[model samples]
Target: MELPVVHYSKSEYIETDTGNKVSRKSVICGSQNIVLGGKTILQTGSVIRGDLKRSGASNFVVVSAGRYCFLSQSCIIRPPCKAHKGAFNYFPVKIGDYVFIGESSIVQAAQIGSCVSIGKNCVIGKFTIIKDCVRIEDNTVIPPNSIIPPFSVYRGSPGKMVDELPESIREIYEARCKDRYTKFVPSVDA
Candidate 1:
């Protein structure tokens, strides 16, 4: 199926390549500092913010989206402070290919590998490294600077490696990505 060409308001500020699809409702603030790569799809209501650096420049929020990666509704991507002018400035948020970021999650200064699934309302802390094929459950909080070993299931507050998820559940989650939903706005009754 051919993807529809949507008119996004912050067009001048955003640099989108051909074949890369972003929903009209997805917002990219601090556009001067944000970059979206080819074939990436930033779904409805996702927000990308960049902080001010000490040099009076904007911090760079480098989002390297691998082919077929999908960032769902209301996902927040903020650059690390170390990557800015502050003492806490850190590196950019890098997401690998075929990764899925669930609704309403916050990903800051973290490295997410390919085929990983971050659930709804999850908070990925600064400088955290999530290895490939990891599955994080909904509402989980991953601490800063922590390492999540590859091919594991992490759940609960300050997420920890639980156990290998059942193959059935894993398959279900993976299949969910096939049906990506766009936002719907209801009309007012006059």
Candidate 2:
């Protein structure tokens, strides 16, 4: 699916050499622990909390996103935390290519596979695992530790598998992600 072209203020975003466009208003903590593959877009007011790492002295990624990932406005992406040995420990968040998280979504999932489209105002609970080619509808709330299978559609609070996706869903999501990335441009008047 092709998305409409959206113009943004040139001064508000920074486009990197690897084709990653990050908004200046986005709050990304612990930059060293955050890895973004090429052609990823982090829109304004998005927050990536890479600062919360596991309770240990290991230098590793807290949030690793693949190519062409899109995090919409005001979205919060954080590492999932759990209590282990009477202490809190943060785990990594792995997002694959062509994943689109809609506006105002809070995602604390452990893993989100390729070609996943998450709609607006959703809450993906901590430790949730979403496999490839999945579509989560708007305002959905996935429970913690839930594993969403591949080629499925989930909706509503305590999101459940409402339908199965077509085999071509991966291709469709990949194209959509590419189209959105290409269409996101700086306004000429800016």
Candidate 3:
């Protein structure tokens, strides 16, 4: 049996030669400051706020995602902010390779390590650091400045560790992320 269509046609998303596909409908401010590694997918209606940079004279990246990463539809990926010594500034969001951010999630995270999977509608508060091989369940709310250790699953409103991921799942996660990138194609007909 053939697989049903999910993602919009490849045409709707601007596919770079390196396989980075960004939806036309997505709102990306300060495109120059955003760094996307090859084969990254930014789905429709996602908002990447690269415009919110740190307060300084030097040029700093606001949002940087590694290769084979996926940001789902309507998600908001913005830099985290905080007040330091009476001055407030936005910190960069660093996402490692093979990361998957679910739909409608608002991420104001400091770092998301490789093989991390975040479910839909979650709100990741500022300065949240998600370590490698972590899974966050849908609708979860992570408190600010929280650090998720590796190989764990966090769920619930005040996101708590529910379980640990098996070491075997690392390869599986990598394969799934890579597969999704390869299978995303534009629909022949609307």
Give the top-scoring candidate (lDDT): 2
For 56-108, candidate 1 gives per-residue lDDT tens digits of 34554555556556677899887555544445444567777667888999987
lDDT at position 50, candidate 2: 94
List TM-scores for all candidates, in order.
Answer: 0.70, 0.97, 0.94
Please report, in order, the local distance difference test score of every candidate based on alpha carbons: 0.68, 0.96, 0.91
Error of 3 at 79 (Å): 0.5
Q: Let me know the TM-score candidate 2 reaches against the reference structure.
A: 0.97
Worst 10 residues of 3 by lDDT: 1-10
Candidate 2 lDDT, 26-139, residue by residue in tens: 999999999999999999999999999987746889999999999999999999999988998999999999999999999999999999999999999999999999999999
lDDT of 3 at 109: 93
Clashes of 3: 3
Model 3 lDDT tens row, 50-154: 999888735677899999998999999999987889998888999999999999999999999999999999999999999999999999999999999999999
Weakest 10 consecutive residues of candidate 2 by summed lDDT = 51-60
User: Residue 151 in model 2: shift from native, Å?
Assistant: 0.4
Itemize residue pairs with steric clashes in candidate 3. Answer: 9-186, 9-187, 10-186
- The lDDT, on a scale of 0 to 1, for candidate 2 is 0.96
Instruction: Sort by lDDT, best first.
Output: 2, 3, 1
